[model samples]
Target: MDQGIVKLLPAVRGIAREAGEVILRYYTDTVTAHVKADGSPVTAADNAAEAVILPALHHLTPDIPVISEEQHAAGKSPPGDHGTYWLVDPLDGTKGFIEHTGEFTVNIGLIKDGVPVLGVMYLPVDGDTYAAAGPGTAVYGARARHDVPISCRVVPADGLVVLSSRRHGDRERLDKFLEGKLVKEHRHSSSALKFCLIARGEVDIYPRFGPTCEWDTAAGHAILLAAGGSIETPDGQSLAYGKPRYLNGEFIAYGRK
Candidate 1:
């Protein structure tokens, strides 16, 4: 494990939890979604969570710039040349939030040289967090540091458990993408929990043909990567960060190294 990351991870976990707390306030109220420039929904909760997370992340790692979803929507951006920066989705899954589903998350991921080396994801409603730092083992918890170290499991011979996005992508497209794969069941979830399930060994793979931003996958990517798994392009190459415009291409996540 990177010693620096070891020291940094705990502070980041606290920051994520604090941001989650901020989102809960909005969740309990009737949150009114405001559309962003890209036609994605936003709310007071997104702004509030980003405001709380951004400063604390800067405080924890003074040299790292935070590129947050809400901030980006407001045209606030950091230099593109930065090799180490934080990618934050202060509130992921706005539709789910509006629907009162407890599937949204607060995501903070550290990208270094185009790869996520650390991440923290918090589920506000339940206070569950799945996090990883550098090469250290990943962990899952509810309201505490961690309950257990998480690692991915191999695909079972009986078939595979797959994770699917709740309201994104076309089912037919996914069916086509999954043609010959043996799948026993599909678990539908929103936001970053799909990746957490891969890290927790609850699923074998997650394939997506839908559009997603860097913040949407970075934290989960890091946790999954650390938990003896990886994310890759359909062509089988590793997925990388720091791409043009922070956009993501179609990719699949596997619960194996």
Candidate 2:
């Protein structure tokens, strides 16, 4: 199964990039956002990207069930076997995308037994991609170059480099969480880019206090895991997937853990 997953990674990356391309077709300063029942924003870019990804993913692996954001939001999720499935967020950071922040991404992750075994995250604006298939298979790429191996770096003696949500986060809670830690630098990013930054050794930790769905983190979690990092609950358990309604609680992502 690992071999099969490895073989399918390139195809998954291709699908993510293609979805990103579709998303870019809807990118503009005046992009409109519609409010979902849950009060979160959605856009045509999100739907268009999902439209590209779902069919491509189905064609690539017919047996694997897909749980995509838009599809699920529309009450059209598939029943999975619980052992293997696809989790996709066609457009993460929709607010940023609508506001011209250019921080959104196309995320695809393969989960097996509640763990993400494969992930592909593509930034449509820059054509940057981060991918992984199990451990020791993490890589980063862009239009100029592809598949450059990446890994997490040990925290420097000075302090930890941290990433926080740009659009939203529990600032008071995050401050409390970092009270005793030595933070050398603190930065803000939208969506799963924080995970990619840690995977590429640009950052050290991401302490998220607010709620997020499974699709929001799965792909980034897989890439982080493949890069020798870890994401754990507040009490220090490994973060598992396939939760009811795909909701996630607080978790901290770390590099070189």
Q: Using Cα atoms with residue i matched to residue i, what is each candidate's TM-score against the true structure?
A: 0.96, 0.97
TM-score, candidate 1, is: 0.96
For residues 3-121, could you state the per-residue lDDT of candidate 1 as single tens digits? 88778888898899999898888886577988877888888898899999988988888899988888887788886577988999999988889889888999999999899999999
Task: Give candidate 1's error at residue 192 in angstroms.
Answer: 1.0
- The numbered model that scores best in TM-score is 2
Clashes of each: 0, 0
Model 2: worst 10 consecutive residues (lDDT sum):
77-86
The sequence of per-residue lDDT tens digits that candidate 2 reaches over residues 167-186 is 67788988899999999999
Off by over 4 Å in 1: 144-146
Global local distance difference test of model 2: 0.92
